[model samples]
Target: MAESVKAPKTVKVASTAGSAAGSGAAKAASKKKVKGGVINVAVMTLAAGLIATMAIPAYAFNPQGADAAQFKASAIDGMKKAQSQSVEVPETVAASAVARDAASATTEEQLAAAKAAEAARQRAAVSLASYASSYSGPSVSDFLANPPYPNFSLDQVFSVAQQYIGTPYVFGGSTPAGFDCSGYIMFVYAQFGISLPHSVSGQAALGKRISIEDAVPGDVVIMPGHDGFYAGNGNIMDAPDTGRSISIRPIWTSNYYIVRLGI
Candidate 1:
């Protein structure tokens, strides 16, 4: 019985030892398998890196080439050739441009001159209208037919002249409506058939000179460039000048003489 127990115990110990050995072998085999898998993964990663490197284009590393450099040089040469070239205009075209500018300037000058002439014409028309408007009274023919004075005496002539005392002074008037210095005398004498020129100097020559002391109210008073009716005591009655009416005023100057018409 002791031998049998001892034998069984020995068998159990051998079985336990076999089981531990089998477990250790399995662990070693698993470690070897894991190490082999790691190595395979490393080798695969190296192969993939090599494939990626080989896939890239060779030109990506070195961009500039002979063809690109030649193209850039050709473009620069074309630009320089275009800039250096000179464009010439035709002589006829240049002449035509000059003539066009000259014609434009001449046309402007003519238009300005025409406008100035038109303005001058308008001003003359207005002045003529004003001159026409001043005369609305009797004409020289009316006074000639029906003489206001029965006798052609100096006092009678002056009395006939007094009827138109308020007439306006016109530059070249002779009617009752308006009168200048000499026109007043002419109009007054025209009624008496005493034809006198409508000029101060002409009228002065027609009359006989008289001393101022012997002068009467109807005598003609002659000055250097003017004439009027002598209104005794150094007074005169006549149409004076522009913007003035026929009026009576003291003789303004001493360089004057008295004259009697139809003397």
Candidate 2:
């Protein structure tokens, strides 16, 4: 009975609700700590990645290494090979170049020939001038006194006149060296003892006016300010202007009539 009475003494025990509430509070605290730790780890990882990127050199991402150098060398070599390659010229293009060269050469040759011909003409003119300037032939007085073709016919007079065909023209000259228009007539007729004036009008008046058709080769051709020997067939033989030799040529004008000297 005494043991039973000692066990009946009251014992202090905790409530279920308080225990559950305390357990919930501790669980919330643990969750909060775990979330904070996860956030800290993520922050540290981002900081380490930023530091690593900053530590790297900018050239690390560039492709300018040995491969780029080899590509540049290959490009340069290709350019050199292209420059050294020989391109064949087309036959048509080559022939065109040759033809152009030949044409240029021919033009040069033609120019040279023309220059030579002009020089020759000038030389001939100079020779004639020199021969006229240095002449020492018979004078008009000597020729008149001697009268080489005395009693000569008109044909003989013309034949004698032809001997001085190549004589040069000179102003107011009547010798064999050079002769003017009227002076030539005077000198020629002097050989046949025919006294004539050394003037166009005077000589024209001393002869008979004749038609051109009826004129002979020895007849005188009288123009407005000129006169010559009628060479028949509308031609005349006379000393022309300055720088020209005595020659036979066609009558240049229709304003002229024939004159028979011994009419």
Candidate 3:
């Protein structure tokens, strides 16, 4: 803060003329000295007013919230901070964008897998169609003599069966190139619009029971954990197991039961 300056005091001095009624010259000298004292007081009052104007703060009279320089600096700093923030992204927002990209990639992969599965199903249908009409075998009427059912031909079973004659046995596989015993059975029957579960015991329960003594073509010959399609003359076309070929071979066991696939 600026220091308060004190104004010098103006003192009035008496004339010391020779006497009160001395002469006219003496009175004139007294009046001249009085005017000089008044002039000195005026000069001193003006100087004091000038000093007070320079020393007093503007806030002491009409105050303001902020000075111009301080306000300008604050504004400039705020603008610089905003500019720096505009070019950067928050970590949370960046992570959300990456998550969306990963989700999109996973959806595309699932779509591709679905398309491949559909394509495989269509090719299997085509292969079955090519063999459907090639076999000429006993009709369903032969094995289902006592039942009142339609006489559907069994040729389709044998036709589809023959196509996989040399296909290697593959555990849990049902494709034409390879199959397990029950897998082979289910694959062939599927062409004739039969749905079978991929299990040996499951296959044994799917058809009408027939004694091996009265068995005919299209009968299911089920053993302990194996099964095959009954070819006429006691032959069976089947995928034996892993590391074997599907073939029309003789019934290898009498410890078996027969089940006719359809009436």
Candidate 4:
């Protein structure tokens, strides 16, 4: 009743062969994965080396160095060499200071002179007004005895006259302290905004030339012998010669020239 079943030898061998094939496939797949990982790591290492080589040299050659300390030292060294030959300030600078001081003094002198001249003008106006109020003629007769110079105005002549009221007459002076014939003419008309020539002869060509009969109060009455401004009433004011002061003279001279200095 006991029949032992005999196993098939071929079946056992086939089962063993299938198990071996499965194990070989799994090992090949693992080896392929590891190879790919090794290849990726090598590529990364080569790229890192190339980048470091290029960047290091570029930084060293440029003036703006990669390191802050190196750049500062280089800049300081260059500046020290450039400033080695500068010169000191010279002594001539003192002379410039002195010249500036002189200019300031000159400006002060001009200011003082201008103030004195203004004061003198005010005094003359007051004196003339007082004298006119007490006079007896018809408002200080216009100069010419015969035919008055229609071109010359008495007001214009009076303007020139006011500049010399109490001013001391000097021999060759043209200023407030003194005056000559030409200097008197030059100074008086200058106050009236009329710029006359320095001499009497030169003044004779100022406005319109006329005769003594045609001269007005403001007219400049010239003489071949002497020169003066017509001050009405046959009287002429002049800074006559070197000895005489600025005073009234006669316009009835035999030879005289008359000029009017207005438009």
Tens-digit lDDT track for model 4 on 154-185? Answer: 68556657557555444445555555567666
Model 3 residue 211 CA deviation (Å) reads 2.0
Put down candidate 3 lDDT per residue, 102-142, tens digits, no spaces: 87775777989999878766655554454344434432232
lDDT of 2 at 94: 100
Any idea how many clashes model 3 has? Answer: 0
Q: In order, what lDDT does every prediction score?
A: 0.81, 0.82, 0.71, 0.63
Badly placed stretches (over 4 Å) of model 2 are 1-133
TM-score quality measure for candidate 1: 0.49
lDDT of 1 by residue, 92-201 (tens): 99999999998777577798999987876665455446767766755667767776654778778878888889987776778765678998899888888777898999
In model 4, the Cα lDDT at residue 158 comes to: 66
Question: Over the stretch 86-169, how does candidate 2's per-residue lDDT look in tens digits?
Answer: 779999999999999987775777989999878766765665576567868776677778988777688987898899898878
* lDDT for 246 (candidate 4): 68
